[model samples]
Every structure is written in structure tokens, then in C-alpha cells.
Target: MFTAGHLAANPLPPGIVGALGLGGYQLLADIAGVGAGRLGSQAFLLVAADPDPALPDAGTQISLHQTRLRDESEAAAYVQLAAQLGYLRLSGYRLAPDRHGLRSRINLVNPATGAIAATIPDRAGGRLLRGGPGASQLLVTAGALPPAG
Candidate 1:
């Protein structure tokens, strides 16, 4: 169950919700963990319940796992490695870079409809933006992350 206090205690970084445009979804779970490394970076796993537009009673769930990196350069390196390993080619996903080339993301396209089903941003500043159904239209609205302090 989601609660106001829980969200207040573990709030998502600014612009995350608007970036993903998760307006209608309901928060289900939020888990934070330590990244595997000497730095012991922070990581988070978020699960949300997404209501299906076609079927009122039927719904789906989406999850996003974000890791806090040391900096934008480190995050870019991680995305590059993932792409080199052909991880982005799985399931008909194509790698797309933002206009500024600061971020790279994998977009999953539906074969039948050719509509984007999901988007996974593997970019700088330690954000892993994952999107589910109805995300295709919103991705264009996602702006760059704020400068790291």
C-alpha cells in the first residue's frame, strides 16, 4: 500500500514524474538498495500499478530501477557498455539518443502496431527512466535532468 508519509520520506528526484508522465498510475512499491561497488552508490526500484485504458478492470504494472552514479560521464559509459553488448537489440528495441546526445535510451516498439510500448533511458546522471503502456507519447516531453550539484 502507498501512503503520503512514505512518499514524503522517500521522494523521487525532481522532474522524474513529469519526465515519465506517470500521472494516472498508482504507486505500489518503492525499494532502495546499495549499488554494488566500493562507492556503495544508491539505487532504487519503483513499482507502480497502471490502469489499462481499454479494460477498466484489467491493469498492468511497471517498474523502474534507478542508480545514483558518481557523475554524468560514468552514466554515459554504462549506457555505452550496454549498447555494445547488444542489450538494446533484444525484443526489437532500438537505441535512440537525445537531441543533446547527453542521454541514450532504448525504445521497445510493438511489431504489430509499430507503436512504442516502452522506453528505457540509460543515460547520464544516474537515471534509468523506464516507461510502460501509454508512454510513447509522453517520452517526447521528458526534458534533461537538472544539473548535478
Candidate 2:
């Protein structure tokens, strides 16, 4: 489970605002990413299951943990991480036969409002990747909105 504070530290794209329940987990939003006319707060509910190297356990159950991305630089870093995690779905890893490098499809919606916000190519088999010093962070930017017209 993730708190809003955690999201604030990382990020949920720009319009997602933050995540609530990841399937069943309840997420809390902490006021950490809101400041100086910027959206900087977020919290996600995730479960981290123990990884079984034996037969590919195949799932994770993250607990309530917190990490912060205070400034835009940090936020950009997060975005970069997301991009590296093959989030964009457009220019990442190459699928099987289409090794020519085609973009995947990505779509993030507000489950509450039934609204579609972000859309990118989709990955053949999209799954959450691990995070670490040289890993891509799965910062969901689903509900965020574009600047005013």
C-alpha cells in the first residue's frame, strides 16, 4: 500500500493526481507534491509479494512505503525512469518479429470517472518492472491534465 506522500515524492505522470486502489488495495493521498503552483503530491496502494526465483513467482505485493521527488529535477528524473521502464510504449524495447522497433500502446484511465487521460502504445505483455538504482520506476501518470487552453 502506498500513501499520497509516497506519490508526491515520486509522481503519477502529471494529470493522474494520484492513484487510489490498485485493484483492491486502498491508497492514501498525502499533500507533498502541491506547492509553488505545481502538483507534487501522490500516494499509491501497492502490494509487494515475495519474489520466488525458483519458478517465476509472477507477481508483487508492495507495502506502504514512501519516497520523495521534491523538485522538477527529481520529477524529471522520475519521468525519465518511467520512460526507461518502457512506459511510453512508443520507443522502448522491440517486440518479437517487429524488431524494427515499433511503439507499444499505453492507456491510463480514471476508474472512478471512466475517463481516458493518457494514451501510449501498448506493450505486448505489460507488467510492472522492478525499481532500483538502475531500474525504471513505475510512476503512473494517469489522471493528470494538460495545461489550460
Candidate 3:
């Protein structure tokens, strides 16, 4: 998980902002074009209720995801990564389809279906890098796939 600091900086699509009505909610992460599919793809403005410690799985049960777009691709992801002037700016991987994988400080395949690898998270570990009055943070969780029989 990553902290999205530019939620309010970029101009989000009007219809989406209205649909989620996240105006007063606690924004967790704001993803730009991280998802994809046959029809199209989109971005996300993740929000959630206050963190709940009562949940299971290493206090990670409490998470947030708000889909914001469709038809997203490596190119779009690259654009988002490049366009951002924040910590995640240098993440753009040259927009090459052959090497089109999502990356953060930690190296992992982009979870997007059409990403570098269309693999799903099977297991993992995570840590809270930061929690503040402002500035979203990138959290880490460790996981891997099981052995095939």
C-alpha cells in the first residue's frame, strides 16, 4: 500500500468525484490508471473509515479501494508515474510493454490484469511507513505464490 499525497492536486474526472462523494471522507490512496480490462480501465481514489485494529491478518484487515477509471495500460501507468512530481515519480518504467510492470520501492509485478504479469497476490507481509496528519504513505506487505504440485 502507498500513501497518495496528490489526491487533491490533480483534477479528477467530475463524474467520478460525484459518484464516490468522497469529499469529506478520509482519503487513503489516490491511484491513477492502475486497473485494466476488456472494455476499458480507470483510476481510483481510495478512502476508508478510521483504521480499525480489531481486524485480523496483522491489522491489515482494514484497507480501502475506490475504483476511479477504466482502460488503464502500461502507457497510462507510465504517464501517471511520470506526471507525478512526488515520491513515486521515478517509477515510470520507460512505458515498454515488454517490461511493463508496476513498481514501488519494493519490486513486485503489477497486479493489473494486463500488466507485466497478470499474477495475483497469494501471500504477503506489510509495514506502515508513515501515518500523519497529512501526506499519504506507502505501506509494505510481503506475499508470494504457492508451489505447484
Winning candidate number (lDDT)? 1
The number of clashing residue pairs in each candidate reads 0, 34, 22
| C-alpha root-mean-square deviation, each candidate | 15.8, 15.9, 16.6
Residues 39-103 of candidate 1: C-alpha lDDT, one tens digit per residue? 12322223222224664521111122233445544433333333221222333333222221322
For residue 131, give model 3's deviation from the true position in Å: 29
Model 2 — TM-score against the truth?
A: 0.22
Among all windows of 10 consecutive residues in model 1, the one with the lowest summed lDDT is 31-40
Scored by lDDT, model 1 comes in at 0.31
Candidate 1, residue 140: the lDDT equals 31
Per-residue lDDT for 1-149 in model 2, tens only? 32345333543332222332222222232222211112233221221222246755322222212233334454443344333322222222221111112221323333344444443331211223733321123344321333212
Whichever of 1 and 2 has more lDDT, that candidate is 1
Provide the overall lDDT of each model, using Cα atoms, as 2-decimal numbers. Answer: 0.31, 0.28, 0.25
Worst 10 residues of 2 by lDDT: 91-100
The estimated TM-scores of all candidates read 0.24, 0.22, 0.24
Residue 79 in model 1: lDDT? 30
> In model 3, what is the error at residue 68, expressed in angstroms?
17
